[model samples]
Target: MQTSLAKSVTFNGVGLHSGAPVRMRLHPADADHGIVFRRIDVIGMQNRVHATWDRVTPSKLCTLIENEDGVTVSTIEHITAALAGCGVHNALIEIDGPEVPIMDGSSAPFVAGIRRSGIRFLRAPLRAIRILKPVEFKDGVATARLEPADGFEIDFAIDFTDAAIGQQSKRLEMANGAFVRELMECRTFCRQADVDHMQAHGLALGGTYENAIVFDGDKVLSPGGLRRPDEAVRHKMLDALGDLSLAGAPILGRYVGNRAGHAMTNRLLRALFAQPDAFEYVTLDADQERLLPGAGVCRPVALAG
Candidate 1:
């Protein structure tokens, strides 16, 4: 069955890039509402930004969505991923700024909020996107592809020259609350050089060692340490799930990403839509529905990673 949040939940924090404090809330919506962002700060314009592939604007650092009126919400990947992680399909996300708060640089905080507010199943049947054929997109060496699969899964690989974060690969079958248990708490990571560069360009102004894993070659610079052994790769898979949720429906496919980020994932969605025969919308069978990302995710406990 489709579901929505049982009650509204609120969050307040500073934007990672903008460095401006913001507030956001998630309100339960009707069955087919999908996920839509409302800019409460916009006085007299169409403030609704549908979390859909067509609305995505190009950005490497984060997943951004813009409406026809040019209203936008930046850094939505974590929230979107949290929604997917909880299996909450229809939500009206209200925000008071142009960007969502970058809470802890991971979906853990959002996951905690959603679990606390709980979920209410709707009466409507669920719909999902089932890949009929493989669709691939590439930019330089980075690539993203989706192929037919009975259940949702992610296989990702990342390679960095920095010794601290060299080549890492992971394959996850996102079933039975695998997202919450295996991927939710992994924080975003960046090299010290990248942080220096982003700060020089007036970006990552809100970034701190507290929120992200800052690593130098062969060294972890963040205060504590990694939440898990391969946190970087797990976080990439988490990001992929969030970006894929923007397709406006659950996808039953094997997503393979090789050093791919937000832009490449968005482009992959565009390519999927461009090819009519590559995918199809379907009402899932009992077995298939049970094999999706948020299966049995009723309570967001301290799941083992």
Candidate 2:
């Protein structure tokens, strides 16, 4: 069955990139509505942006979507990931700003809010995209690909110059609440040098040790140390789940990423759709639906250890 939030849930925080205070609300939508973002801040014009690959706009750090009127919202990957992980088929995300709140730089807050609001089943059936052939995208050394699989899976690998995050790899079948229990709370991270570079260029004004895990050489600058030894890679997998959500439905395939970022994943989607023979839409059978992430998920657990 298709699902959505039982009611509206509100979130207030600063945007990670814009650093501006914003208020966003997630409201349940009718079946087939998909996920649409509304820029309530827009005046006297159309302000609806669909959370899909076709609506995506190029951004260096995060996933961004825009409508024809140029109404855009940035940094939506986390919440989008949460929605997909929770098996929410449709929602209307209303934000009175140009970006979604960053919250704690993880999808946990969104997941918790959604759990509190609860889940509502829709009368319509759920559909998913099936990979009929492999599609790969490469950007220099970074790469992402999608290949046929019985269920959704993610295989990710990352290598960083910082000894603190030298090399990490992880793979998971994103089903049976694995996304919620394992990947949901992993926070976005960056090297201290990169943070300094961003700040030098007048960016990441709202970033702090609390929201993002910062690494400097071999030391973790964040006061809390590490949530998990392999958190950096877990966060990458978390990000992959969120980025893949832009496909507009659950995907029955294996996603593999190597040092990939938001842009590369978006480009991978473009490649998938470009080759019409690469994928096809189908309504998932009960067994197939049970294999998708959040198929049996309910509420989120505690984020604090």
Candidate 3:
């Protein structure tokens, strides 16, 4: 069955790049609504931007979606990941700003909000984009690929020169609340030098030591350090799931990312759809539905990263 939120939930925070304070709400929608973002601040023209792969436009360091009328929303990955991980297929997201709030630089807050709001299963049947063959996209050293799998899974690897976040890899089956338990609390990470460079250029204005994990050479500048030893890679997988959700349906496949970012994953989705034979939409059987990312997930007593 398809699922939507039982009641509306709200979030307030500042945009990571723009540093503007923002308010956003997630409301339940009819089955098949997928996920749509409405820019309430836009006075006229088409304000609704569908969260689909084709609507994705290149942005710096975050996933961005734009409408034909030029309305855009940036830094949506964390919220979208929360939705996907909660098994939410239909939602109407209304925001009064151009960017989704970067709440704690991770999807945990969103996940908690969704769980609190509760999930309402729709009467409509659930469907998923099942990978039929391998589809891959590469940009220099970074790559993203989707291949046949019984359930959604992620294999990601990252190698950074910063000793605190040096080479790390992780693979996980996303079903059975694995995302909430293992990935949701893993915050975004960046090198201290990169943070300095981006800030000097007037970017990441809302970033603080509390939200993102800041690594300075051999040390972690973030106060609490990592929630898990392999947190960086797990956060990458969290991002990949959020980006993959842009396919506009649940996906049943194995996603492999080698230092892949938002752009590479979006390109991989384009590649997957470009070749019709690479994937197909299928109505999910009960057994198959049980294999998806958020099957049977309930509000967590405590989040583990």
Runs in model 2 deviating more than 4 A are 299-305
Candidate 1, run of 10 with poorest lDDT: 296-305
- Count of backbone collisions in candidate 3: 0
Report lDDT per candidate: 0.91, 0.90, 0.91
lDDT of 2 by residue, 211-302 (tens): 99999999999998988899999999998898899998899999999999998999999999999999999997789888998887864222
User: lDDT tens string, model 3, 1-305?
Assistant: 88888889999999999899999999989888899999999996999999999999998699999999999999999999999998889999999999999989999999999999888878889989999999999889988899999999999999898888889999999989899999999999898889999999999999998989999999999998889998889999999999999999999999999989999999999999899989999999889988988888844232111
The local distance difference test score of model 3 is: 0.91
Q: How many steric clashes between backbone atoms does each model show?
A: 0, 0, 0
Ranking by lDDT: 3, 1, 2
Estimated TM-score for each candidate: 0.96, 0.96, 0.97
Colliding residue pairs in candidate 3: none
